[model samples]
Target chain A: MSVYPISSPPSPQAVMDTSFWSLCCYCGLEPYLWKVWARPIWVPTVVKNQIFYHAGDYPDQQAFQQAEHEGLLAIRDPQIRITQFRSGEREVLSLAQEVSATALIDDFSAHRYAGTILGLDTVGVLEFLVSLLEAEIITLAQAESAYHQLVQLRATNQGWLKWAYNQIKQRGGNP
Target chain B: MATHPQLPLTPEEVAELHRLIAWTGLEEPEALHKLVEAGLAALRLEAALHLYATAPLSTGEIAEQTGIPRGQLIRTIQERRVAPYEDPTIDQPALYRDLDERLKRRVARWKGQA
Candidate 1:
């Protein structure tokens, strides 16, 4: 594919990439996401086709179907095709640019590019959980439970996640 | 004429170089330069992989430190088993802060909408 410039500073629309969406499903945060945010979340069409359709092992397909039925989740095609990173990530960035969206990312490499290279605003799983805690929407215990599940799923025992866990505890006013 | 850089070749290497010169018509300097370039490229790739797997260099840092282009570097990491390492000095703290700010904005926006 011919290389084209794909640059979009995140502005308004909210789109989640495959990895972030998968993380939500695996971490049992799908219901919380749709419940807390009063907006439609989009996934790139490629992600819907590639991962979601074939995600037979995911436990929350029915919930996803319900969200789609309620118009809380949807799929979209990237009008601009940016040839960088993996194809799915390229699509996510492109779709984010196409809609001026805040791109949600979980893959570390793609997350790096999305911030430093693409300059798109992004949200990680830890941030989302922390946001829920800060909003008084979910208790600190719920956030900790979700974080534990995330650690088990990704095997990513990173210090930064612990940092985020501390941020959640500190912000939630728990000693 | 400019004197080309030289490598002290053994007797067997000289004979092999003569055979290669006869077949490929590449002078000794050009052949050695090309081989050295290939070796350096391989060395860079190995070092990049090692730094990636062990240290906490960001993808941008890896590309900047090594001379690999971003697209090619992304493809190489994608094809390999390299895991992502967050730079504690530069990216990790910044990443945590960025998350905090962005999600705060999101939460505030949600509140306004509510």
Candidate 2:
């Protein structure tokens, strides 16, 4: 296990919300998303507290811990404290701003903050799956299956699901 | 240093996103973008409060409707003191009807704002 360098030159990073990470695991997209993330996936301290420490015995906890331990996931503390949102979401939004990175937020409310207030590019979990599909990293069936799995977990909304399905079909993928 | 590729959303995806945005009853793109800026917890608490005061639904039912977890709903109910169990003497049907009217007015105002 290695530590990700905090002082490394700014790279294309994605500050993830705890829910997004958990949803990825629930949708069985962990391995593919991990491979696709080539760069460091920043995980704010508050998110670690919420997803790993507080969410007791979740199946994804071990994998997330391992990813962090292996330097694939970088655990960071936001220098600027944001009091407007909940801890994990606040830290994620703050870190995304601090690094000028894309906010990988799955929660609707949190995504709004990133998109409207912070004026940052926001990507949802479904969008990530779509990206993977577009990059040929995953098949359309895999993306659709992941969407269904996420639906079962109640981690996604109907509107986004339909949008993703339509997007997949338009991209010449069989959704 | 590694760079991440952008998520490949086609023109059709963007159109679909706009359609979904309109479904939220907001015509302006900016207004739709502003929809969920308020925290989910706050929205849930507001919804919970409305349901607690008006609806004959249980805490579990409220949680289901609001997408809040049952455990969190129980804790919120206890902390907020807004459950039926806390005050069993209210006229449920009358309260429901009253709140229904109030909520309609609020929604109309929100739509106007949008």
**Any runs in candidate 2 off by more than 4 Å, and if so which?**
A1-11, A34-38, A53-56, A171-175, B1-114
Q: TM per model?
A: 0.61, 0.56
Clash statistics: count for each candidate = 0, 0
lDDT for each residue of candidate 2 in A1-175, tens digit (9 for 90 to 100)? 2322222233356788776777677777776544434356888875666564444566668778877777678888789866656556677788889888778776555665567778876767776776666556678788878877765554353445656676677767665
Off by over 4 Å in 1: A1-12, A36-39, A53-57, A155-159, A172-175, B1-84, B87-91
Give per-residue CA lDDT, model 1, range A58-147, as digits (tens).
Answer: 444555666677776787777778777545577777887777777776656666677778788766666677777777767877777788
Candidate 1 Cα RMSD after full superposition onto the native fold (Å): 12.0
Residue B88 lDDT, candidate 2, scale 0-100? 46
Fill in the DockQ of model 1: 0.08
TM-score values for chain B across all models: 0.44, 0.39
DockQ by candidate, in order: 0.08, 0.02
Please estimate how well model 2 matches the true structure, expressed as its whole-model Cα lDDT: 0.59
State residue A111's C-alpha deviation in candidate 2, in Å.
0.6
